[model samples]
Target: MKKAIGLFLLTINILLMSCANANQIKKGDMLFKITFAQGFSNDTLSLCLNSCRIVYNRILSSDNTSDGITDLQISVFKKNDSFSAKIFQGKEISCQADIRETIKIEIVLNGSSQSFTIDTKQGAYLSIEKNGNDLSLRQTKEQVLYD
Candidate 1:
């Protein structure tokens, strides 16, 4: 029993220390750079479509908009780097592209926002929902929809 109690206390201490090391984010700034492959200069989706894809990263904004992000934009391709990317249209829609992109998302819960980083480019999906006075962030390969 003594050993069990010691283990539990150690676990809690480790978690607290890790959380303290996380970055404190606000509405704007703190950009995460993503690199995608490109082919030509004329510009065509087909060039990268076969090799790369896009994913939506939704994070809660301090602006209080329902969508969280107010003015969201990403430049996947750079003339110098030859990195190309595309953002899906409409609400909660994505290209279903396959790549290894990691981005953090924030969700509003209990009148506040909590951030979570996910790798949608690596075929990852996330669902945030309220579960009895608490919030849950689930990451899986399955589709997650919100009302």
Candidate 2:
């Protein structure tokens, strides 16, 4: 009986961990940063955050593939109260920097990186690993919805 109980407990633990790990992006989670606007404008921040959150949720909800050969690489980790993800596809670079903070996310569909910075403390900007650099709040709407 104890053996059966132990097996059940182990199964439950595995399930819990898998669920937690799968949800790398959570909507309305004030903890993960992805700025939509610059400066201290709360309205811009809120709009950007929510819109991108939805995009991320959709992205992480499944294993995204491209060209049937290249697939997205989404690595997620957390330190203290913050969580971050390095999302990208195509070829991997050797000089990729470790990203961990509230920052604006650049969803680059076209493989060119556009650089921009937002100065703020409310949250860190979110971004795609190397594909996005010149993304705007409206760009999230442009992200393709996978069925």
Candidate 3:
């Protein structure tokens, strides 16, 4: 009977430790979904997050022009109110950002450069669309749907 009780207590302790560790590894608070519209033929997309010192550039291409829309999702985690940026291809990139500061977004698409600032206090979902020779940046609230 005593051995059984000790075993039960040890199992409970292990479970509690795992639960605490799970809380420490948290998902990002903000998720940025960047969509590149079709018709991009070896165009360049440059992004500068938070600072202008380090610029992340990506070559935009359409594998199949008929249905070749490229989407990149960036997850922003806030820790101690500091921010940094990194680039990853074909995968979601996670970074830390300060909610109180404005994030600077610089894009050089199709030989034209444009800059935009975003406040991520409430999170953001940004879209980049190219129309003819112009590029537009738009931010929208993300909708959560449960099935």
Candidate 4:
């Protein structure tokens, strides 16, 4: 009977240890991706995109955002990289002539803004969102929304 009880206790201890380990997240690590428009004119648009990428790196490195992670794991891809802007029917509109050529950026966390360029060009834009429950709260300094 004592041997059986000892085996049961050991099983429980192992299960508890596994559960505890699962709750911990590594520091300075992130999974994200950024894609840019293609066939850029080596001009402002490209510049902006490059600037945005730099800003993105800064944002990712910030402990104020990443919960104290030092290294970032981001996957980047460039699609067709060709898009067109037009003034049609007295209205300004944009279209992707090479629909395959476009930009896409995604990150693990959703909140705050990030900047990046068109690739090697100096154009920039901000990425912002209010993350709900999908984001962990331990690393945040302000009140987060959960829904």
Candidate 5:
């Protein structure tokens, strides 16, 4: 009976240790969805506009990949002006930045080691930039429900 109890205790300890390690190396994903519309204005100008949409994903499966926790920042610029928004899952988030643009969208992630540039309609703009230590929000699926 003593030997059986000792084996059971050892097995339980090993299982708990495995779960804790798994939690430390959590993997996450996020998705950014943006929509743009022309602000109410009397100016009737047809500007040469280009619209493009792109998606990005990152996976942190190991300690090396998790190093992006510190330099996670999001920023947006439009018409040489600055704006802000909230892009975090909750209060525990490290940092978040949001910008609305009338011409372009730029994204930098993983401490800006990887980045992207996008152009939007001249009359409107939309973009979503996400960065963090955890991958809570990721682009699991995307569909163009309408055009």
Candidate 6:
């Protein structure tokens, strides 16, 4: 029947459109991962792309005085060669970043403040570690697995 054939064609078109959307990655899109290696307690972490705050996490004494978030992942996509874009976590939020600008990270703990900057055009992985009174930040390479 013509109705059955038409329905089949419509389904096929929908499938193709979904596949194309899923595989599309625009230019200037970047993925970043931040890891708190050790000594993160009762701290507030803020991540900014250029000047837009994309992620913020705070852990106080009442919540869990012992541990904080260990890993965080963020995906940034540039909008049409402009300085504005959307950041994707579980949802999309408006953010701004320039490829020539650096990502800023600020942390406050124990009445002390620390600031760090990551080059947006560089690697994707970053590690933060605190030893005694010193805090260190470094860009790390992702581990590769072979099967």
Output the number of the TM-score-best candidate: 3
Which 10 successive residues of model 5 have the least lDDT summed?
40-49
In the predicted model 5, the residue pairs found to clash are 29-137, 29-138, 30-137, 30-138, 30-139, 31-138, 31-139
Q: Write the residue-wise lDDT of candidate 1 on 71-147 in tens digits.
A: 33332322222233334333222233432355544434334545556655443344443434344555555444322
Q: Which stretches of candidate 3 lie over 4 Å from their true place?
A: 1-25, 52-55, 62-68, 84-101, 121-123, 143-147
**Candidate 2's residue-wise lDDT over 55-111, tens digit each?**
222222111333221233333334344444444432211212333343443342333
- Residue 136, candidate 3: Cα error in Å is 1.0
Residue 61, candidate 2: C-alpha displacement in angstroms:
15
Q: How accurate is candidate 1 locally (lDDT)?
A: 0.38
lDDT of 4 by residue, 33-136 (tens): 22221211211211122223222223223223323322222232232343222111222222333322133333322233333222212222222322232222
How far does residue 16 in candidate 5 sit from its true spot (Å)? 0.5
Please report how far candidate 2 places residue 125 from its true position, in Å.
8.6
Question: Mind giving the per-residue lDDT tens digits that candidate 3 earns over 64-129?
Answer: 555565544344445556543333354333345444546777777755878778765544666666
Root-mean-square deviation of every model: 18.7, 12.6, 5.6, 18.2, 17.3, 5.5
Instruction: Name the regions of candidate 2 deviating beyond 4 angstroms.
Output: 1-77, 80-107, 118-120, 124-134, 138-147
What is the alpha-carbon RMSD of candidate 6 to the true structure? 5.5
Q: Write the per-residue lDDT of candidate 5 for residues 50-133, one digit (tens) a residue.
A: 122222333212222232231122222232232322223311222123333333343323433332333322222232223232
Error of model 2, residue 51, in angstroms: 22
TM-scores, one per candidate: 0.29, 0.24, 0.59, 0.21, 0.21, 0.57
lDDT value for model 2: 0.35
Model 3 / residue 111 / CA error / Å: 3.9
Clashes of 1: 3
For residue 135, give model 1's deviation from the true position in Å.
1.6
Model 3 Cα RMSD, 1 decimal: 5.6
Alpha-carbon lDDT, every model: 0.38, 0.35, 0.58, 0.30, 0.30, 0.58
Worst 10 residues of 1 by lDDT: 38-47
